[model samples]
Target: MKTALPKLEPGYHQRYIIPMMRIGKNGNKLKVFKIRTMYPFSEYLQEYVVGMNGYNTKGKPNNDFRLTPLGRFIRKYWIDELPQVYNLLRGELALVGVRPLSEARFKELPIDIRERRIHYKPGCIPPYVALLMPDSKGNIEAERIYLSEKEKYPHWTDIKYFFKAIFNVLSGKILSS
Candidate 1:
């Protein structure tokens, strides 16, 4: 939590932490805190980036120039996501479940998935990590699979997926983006 952030221009003061809206439990929107990994005001350029490079396999805008060099490193290591521990503590997230998605990304999901997702808390460790398929389509399918199992056995499903995700990460089968 004490890691140093890169400096912006001399006169520009950067806010190292940012809160982004994500779909939360029961389809409510909530602010989830994250360590900043982009230049200031970069959120305003979402459409521009998408227009230029479009979403990648992971459904993120490709060649997103809004990212700072340090930001890229932070994202790669998931340092930017560390602050979500606060969200977890606040009961907005679970240890294992589908990932919380931004409005744009959430809309891209199929209607059924979208409907089911909101019924459960988003998770820190999503199914993609355990499945080792870190792309948009894979993520949705993995979530569908997970959700199905969760419906049958909620607590047991979480326990199973948690260990799988942990093992995959520790074994270098998956890396955060």
Candidate 2:
């Protein structure tokens, strides 16, 4: 689905919304829509940024200079992720499950986790939110736990995690990163 995008202010000259290639179910790649939250051409510098600063506890590259000031604000509140609803509607994503990892990040996962991950659709709310573990290590552990439980009780697991994540976000116990 394509829509007309308004021109953003001077520093934010990229299109308002952008398509990101994310790993999806069955190890396929899909275009995920998200509001643009970085300066133009930021995608080209991802490797350099990650190499120099490394990933933060939240698994995002540290000292990312590409984020526009408005981008930072929108990301802080997850407004930048709103356009992902289109993906959800298209059945490429779930309301509650793991966040789709970028190609580089997906490659960093353990072999078993990577195998397990491709079996399910990526979600809007990740397991880390429900588990209250926001660090990189905790994030992986949370996903592992979630995937294990999901294997036994797919629907129930998503239902439980969804509510828990909602509660955590609502109560301010877990802030979006």
Query: Candidate 1, after superposition: displacement of residue 166 in Å?
Result: 0.9
- Tell me, by lDDT, which candidate is best: 2
lDDT of 1 by residue, 1-177 (tens): 574544445544266877777889998998888888888877666767878887777656888889889988998887988998999998888989899888877888899999998999999888888887787678889999999999999999999999999999888888877
lDDT of 2 by residue, 1-177 (tens): 965545545654456988887999999998889898888878767878989998787767888999999988998898988999999999999998877988887888899999999999999989999999887788899999999999999999999999999999899998866
Error at 83, model 1, angstroms: 0.4
Task: Evaluate all candidate structures by whole-model CA lDDT and list the values in order.
Answer: 0.84, 0.88
Runs in model 1 lying further than 4 Å from the true structure: 1-13
Q: Of the candidates shown, which would achieve the greatest TM-score relative to the real structure?
A: 2
lDDT of 1 at 106: 89
Clashes of 2: 0
Q: How high a TM-score does candidate 2 get?
A: 0.90
